[model samples]
Target: MENRDVARLLRETARLLELRGENPFRVRAYEQAAEAIEQLDEPVAERVRQGTLTEVPGIGRGLAAQIQELVERGTSEMLERLRQELPPGLPELLTLKGLGPQRVRQLWQTLGIASLDDLEDALRDGRLNQLKGFGPRLHEQLLHALSLRRRYRALRLLAQVLPEAEALRERLRQQPGVIRVELAGAVRRLMEVVDRVELVVAGSAEAVQQVLPQLRQQSGLHGGMLLEGALPDGFPVRVALTTPDAFGTVLWWHTGSEAHCRTFVRTYGAPEPCPEEATIYEQAGLPFIPAELREDRGELEAAAHHALPALIELEDLRGVLHNHSTYSDGRNSLREMAEAACNRGFRYFGTGDHSQSLTIARGLSIAEVRRQQEEIQTLNEQFAARGFRILSGTECDILPDGSLDYPDDVLASFDYVVASVHTRLNMDEKTATERILRALRNPHVTILGHPTGRLLLRREGYPLDWPRIIDACATYRVALELNANPYRLDIDWRRVRDATAAGVPIVINPDAHAIDELDHVRWGVAAARKGWLTPEACLNARDLDELLAWLHQRRQSVQP
Candidate 1:
């Protein structure tokens, strides 16, 4: 597991332990581990392998041992024992923001609140507000947090977030001493939103002085704090700074976490946190970890011990597994969409338009599906003539009861099916998860399309235990579709490592209702790469024959 994955698990473990009323120190140990692992200069996997993981100050030998065990085995025996020891759904309680470990302990120990549902029940029955110290205001905030939990969470792209970062990058580009300039941070990481725009420039202050003042002049920041001791464009984004001593350091800091940098203080012995992040990491002795993994989730620990995984990249994608067309809610015809995919250099394109249930949006009927098949056949003919290929496909909906729109016979006609949840999305956890899980078992369903029916700013589709759903996908050989639409990048990029670690392959689908939507694949691609997706972990990265073979194997297994 990578640091982000480990950190997230640690946080969840803390929540579970808190809910079960486990020891406070043990809980704190997990939380502290999360914090320490996030800022390490190298991947922690390397550290455990080298037998020197405990050299990092925050984590003692026990925590380091836990990290080692987790990496070797897919999970920690300690975490599993906790699972057997706690309320079953207790860990999910952590995902509810505004509810800290202390409050969770209170509700679980005193009021028997183990999960979001139980907590909600207590709130609705007027039991939660009655608790000491958690009066009306805290109760109210808890409800708000619960509502947000049922909704989608996103971070905007850095460039889209920080406009000034762009201005500074241009100025740095013009400087002769500057060797390179690029926007880093959430912008480079491809987060949907961001707190700052990171601009990394390579140069001596003498070479960049002329360009530095131009960056500070622009507005909207904590007043050049990011740039204070460093490069000029650096300061005003989030922290301060306008100067960078070297391009490499800028690259490291710009790509790391705001919370993680604080770990460098002289806990036992070390230089004070340096003005530049490079000195801080270098003194500890290591290579830089990417900012995307800095969630206080053990990234630093992983880096300290060398535990980073090979990240996924755009080139890893050899095909387009999911995209829409004029057949359903899409904008272009099947041929047009296929041609678009071919232009982007994909080996195959799956035309996954909506299934029949979405009648209002003109989702395909059986007759219409047959017509689509004919058109796909024609397109395949032309593609062969031109040395390109298109695979017939459908984004079949997993109905409210867990059944796909079409029967196996109808589904059999297609090369692949991108099964998804579309309507009746507000079901409770059990119902939502089981419904999708049942659909995944359908013989024709090659992939589970956007497990969470989210539409970013529009609505949070439904609530389901994603950890459980991810496990189900792996058991069934069903890949989880990463709908790459800018607005609906569902099966979120943040969940990439978890999904991959579970032995599930991700298909980055630009769930394009239109041909232009195909381009938004870059956003999902960035999220995937940042999430540490490897080429093998992404099904779409495989060539057409490989994808077809996978489908054939899955399909035959479903048949008599």
Candidate 2:
């Protein structure tokens, strides 16, 4: 399989290990492995099959052997055994605040806790606070966790609206005097996810002008468009078309990162004499600013000084990273995932699944890890028969106490690693950052998956000092994962810009568990560009060889 898939498998394996009360260090190892794989350009499983697995580094004999077996089998027996040992829903418990592998295991062992509902009852009744390590403070946090979970469940995948946007585009095209119409804002850049859409119209005010009014006239349209007017600071949205003369200037100015845009205008004062955008920019003496950077950040200023580097584009990406399959709570198989990536014109695909400790997620164990690896290899062989590339990977869970899911030796088995937290979300800023920092030091950790564990509308992640996290990532040269999942756009857009400024490469990952989910990367990339990220700040934009070499550095034990 390819590096992307290898990274996914490592991550899932780690999460499963966490749910099972596996050694914290072990979980960290698996997570580190995932980080390494996510940054790898080549498929680790293929290397194993070619007797070159250890040649890439960190991979010791034990992990390499496990990977070899996974390349031959289709499942891992150890993971299955863990599932049987723990209550079927134990992994889901880990998602709550004040919860982790150890605590959850303790609750299950001592209080017979099996789900979030049971834990909530215990906390309300004061039973949970009586536990030796946990106190009232933690109990309160659990309540917040439940509340956050409810709020963060609904970040819709932006790609899901492409068809609707297209339909609207068609409707706009039929208008008179409409010379051109295209999506602007985040959607135009093919980002990993998005919220709303913006359309740029090229025509006189009269041409597309009718479109907005027509929308208002449509049955039920005016009511839907009405503002709630219920909040103290609620904003209203109005649709109208302006002349092309003012189109670019107005649209770009309004689209925002006011900081970025203010920098642009301040550095190059408003264009005088020319009412048209192109002429204004030409007079301003800067190459036309890309709409993506209209955020009014210092990008406009930097561009004037010829200091800003070329930005990355969607076409620069060679493969798909951070995906999952049926191996652990995913919805597709290795082969299916590979085909989808290939169809998207990607050079490789990463298939990550859950680790063994995540019982609720059906994580993998030692034996199952081998089987899954084998299955990945079998899929790769099948793909190869038709000239395709796939990678075996995993998304490993980061354990509490600053550790990963699997042993170092076992973790080094796959291609890369994507380290993330699946529990203990209530830890205060200090401990949470420390926990993640320790995992970053692992030679196998190549990337930190979703620095923030947030889920949009459902829950916020543990408090973190983002400025420190960005600095740490830069020091370690660990790629910061921009989880493109709509529900969990962690390493938020604003921070993404800061990360680029700090010299940490960003990987926009969909964290897709199904084949159709790969498209989520567009939203994240849109968010990234809005922050003025340059091409060099993104690992996924590099060529395969360059990507592999960079990833090897992360492993710290590899030379090839």
Candidate 3:
């Protein structure tokens, strides 16, 4: 198992133990082992393979055995047994933002509330007020948190769902007489989170009937031409069967946004059955609209006028930026990360390891920053012959009062700075906007990192004044970051168009903490495409020399 998976199980085990009122010492041990494993520079699986898991601090012999079992079996018997002993929905309650095991246990024991539904009923009936700390404010917060949890929990990230969808498609493609299988719904649009997996399958009647048995195994509801069900993992799925001649029309019906489909049907009678999707668009007297542009947000009007933009593609990126290394919280060393980036054909790589003030991430001290710069200079010399450059940068913290974590001199030493807010994320909208605006005015800040401070499916992005933030970036000549991490595709894609329209360039950053994470740039590119980003509007799309020239010009423009 990966270290993260291992750590997550250990942590959950600890929480479950706490919820069950188990021995305090045992719970602490699990918690400690989880923390140690999370911070390890190497994979726990490696240690398990080496038979040295017990050598790690806080990992006792018993804990090591459990971890070994977890790695080998993908689960723990003890955890399973414990889960069986508790209310099934109790573990889910722990996922709420402010509800801890202690509070959850209190609710369970005092009010007999085990599930979210039970909790909601209690909240409505005033039974939650019986607890010492369950006041009106806490009750209201729980209601809000519960709503968000339900909304997010129903959806899964694109990265998580796409592979499974593709596998399903391949499985169906193998069916005899199956002609085609095209993804539809949110998956086709590349939405960050998908509510369900929808597919359009064109095949002979016998082949389509064969597919029904597979859906039936999932306990799906099968109608005349539709099969709706969920994967074994409970992700909802639907399959619509069609003949080969009507494949294009069926795909269009499944793929277009509700609004876009409505507009199309109203403007040009219903689309006729055709073999090609492009033909449908042609019949409507409009150019073929890309799937990502089917949001009906002026896309139809734009297509009518032939003013569609050429969206940025994965191949358009010239450099990978805002990455981290072992100098901070990253697993890989500086040289390893740089070599990986160079091998990937990027002309340049920007290292934006966390700066001091974010201790949780092992943010770099000023001395370490200088040491890293020295290493970067040495690597540049070694890479010179290969036409590669390693740009020294920092993901500097934007302090609450609108000042950067580093002094002006320290910040200026780096080739660029990605100022981010790692703390004080609960500020009011006006305060948050002003804080980011102040950071934008800092000459050394080249990019605003993950401007929303959001973690998809977990935490909401702090509120912001988008128009003001976009205007400030345009005014300061600072680029905005589209952090490409699957968990945090912050600076939501919808706002990317706004910033770019205001002349602010969007820099698609992997925000990578390890070498493998550099590939996350593709996800950022997907989100950028949804925003109609173009190569000319993307900062990293520029070649190295052009990028350097722009950086130089930005510095000059901001200078007194």
Candidate 4:
């Protein structure tokens, strides 16, 4: 079994247990185990085979045994028994944005609402609001959440699908007759969410035909047609079979926005055999456009003029930003995070613990903030001898009234501030835009965190006139963050070019809560590349001295 599959089963078990009124600690344990498995670099199945499953953090002997059973037998008896006890739709209800286990239980017991449709019916009939905690605001939000859920039902996060797609590509490459495999479509474009995985296989049609049956019978593949396949979970996979000579043409054709392909055809006629993608573009008398830029967004014209910007690379980043530690919701301590960042070749680390409004994250009190600052100062001194720096920062909340959570004096104490909206996310576009603008105007705010508050497929961001937000960031000289967490790659790539064009600097922040999460910067860099940002346009790509100087300059610009 894939680690993701095992993680999903464990998570499902936790949710089912919650629905059954199991002990809170037990539910939390399962949830933690699931998290540990999801973040695991090596497969749980491999660990099980090695008899080292218990060595994984959060996986005790009991959980390790369960994982081994699930991995070896392909099913967990405990999970199946829990499924038998709860209404099947009860698990689906837990997916709604605001519906926690307790709320789901209330709906089930108080109103017999076990499914989304049932909850919607209760809302329509005014029965839902009659419950103790249900209110008009939450009712409306739930409805919106359901709509978003339905709209994005088939889409999977890029992080989830990329690994699966790559694995399938590797398997295809191993097939006897497959010459080469290249990902195409939105997956190639590095879109944040994609509904299907598309690939092009280079080999003769006869060779492809010979290998087709064996390919379909591979593990994890359920149903497949001549050129289409499905995973056990029903994710669609589309493939184009072609000869090695036409590999580039096939890849280019399938890795397209219709407009891009049409423009290519109009400019250069139909695709013909070419050894590589660069050759096809060369034949068309244009520079080779990166796959991420093949979006029909004036890229062809730019390539024709040899004017494409050098996209930002992962190695261009010199520092890590907006990271959390034990001062807040983070699992790692300040020193550990700093050490990890340095080990990863970063010259500096910014500590952005939650500020006083997000109590659930253990937001720092004024006294706590001061203490953290002192700790950072000591660490900086210790690291200074080695030419490394740790910057004291805070992910300060932008309150409902558009004011910051910390007073001016308190905010000034930090080397940088990442102003973000942690609550009141349902505001209208104007209010949301204005609130963010007010925060941007704060001279101390170095970066705007996850500018839209989006959580990938889970919740839609508060609506905003993004063009205006970009203009404001530019005017205020504030850097907009491309939050690197897979769940919240906000300041979405689609809007990244707008920010870059407006001369707004983009900061690729992992927003990491743990040391391992620091690796999310790679995803952030990919998102930036998709948006056509170059190293020159990214704040994090600046060297330590240059970065600190820029921060000092921004602060001084606002001083009297």
Top-lDDT structure, candidate number: 3
- Per-model lDDT: 0.71, 0.67, 0.89, 0.86
After superposition of all CA atoms, the RMSD between model 3 and the true structure is: 2.9
Ranking by lDDT: 3, 4, 1, 2
lDDT value, residue 173 of candidate 3: 93
**Residue 320: error of model 3 in Å?**
1.3
Candidate 4 lDDT (Cα, 0 to 1): 0.86
Per-residue lDDT over 228-304 for candidate 3, one digit per residue giving the tens place of the 0 to 100 score: 76787888888887777888888888888999999988888788888778999999899999998899888999999
Q: Which digits, one per residue and each the tens of the lDDT, describe model 4 over residues 1-560?
A: 87768878888888899898999999999988987776565678789889997788888999999989888888799998998878888888888878999999999998899888898888888998779889888999898878887878889988889998888788778877778988998999898889988888875445554544323422211111237656668888777776677677778877877889899899888766775888888888888899988888889999888899999999999999899987887767899999999989899999999999898788999999999989989998899877789998999999998899999999999999999998988789999989988888888888999988989888888899888888988888899999999889988888888998899999999999888899998788878888999999999999999998999888888774
lDDT of 1 by residue, 1-560 (tens): 77667767777677767766678888888887876665454567888889887887768888888888877885888789888987776666765645666777777778888888898889889987667887887788678877765543333434245456677688778888776667776665567656455665555445555765444323323212244233343333432233444444445445545555445332314334234555656676755656566555566777777876677777777877678776775646677778888888887887887888887557899999999889888878878966678888888888888998998889889988888877776688899888888887776778888778776654566788888888888877888888777667777777888988899989898877666777777777767766777788889888777877888887777664
The worst-scoring run of ten residues by lDDT in candidate 4 lies at 217-226
Sorting all predicted structures by TM-score, with the top scorer first, yields 3, 4, 2, 1
Model 2 RMSD vs true structure: 12.8
TM values, all candidates = 0.64, 0.65, 0.93, 0.83
Off by over 4 Å in 3: 21-29, 39-41, 60-62, 209-224
Worst 10 residues of 3 by lDDT: 215-224
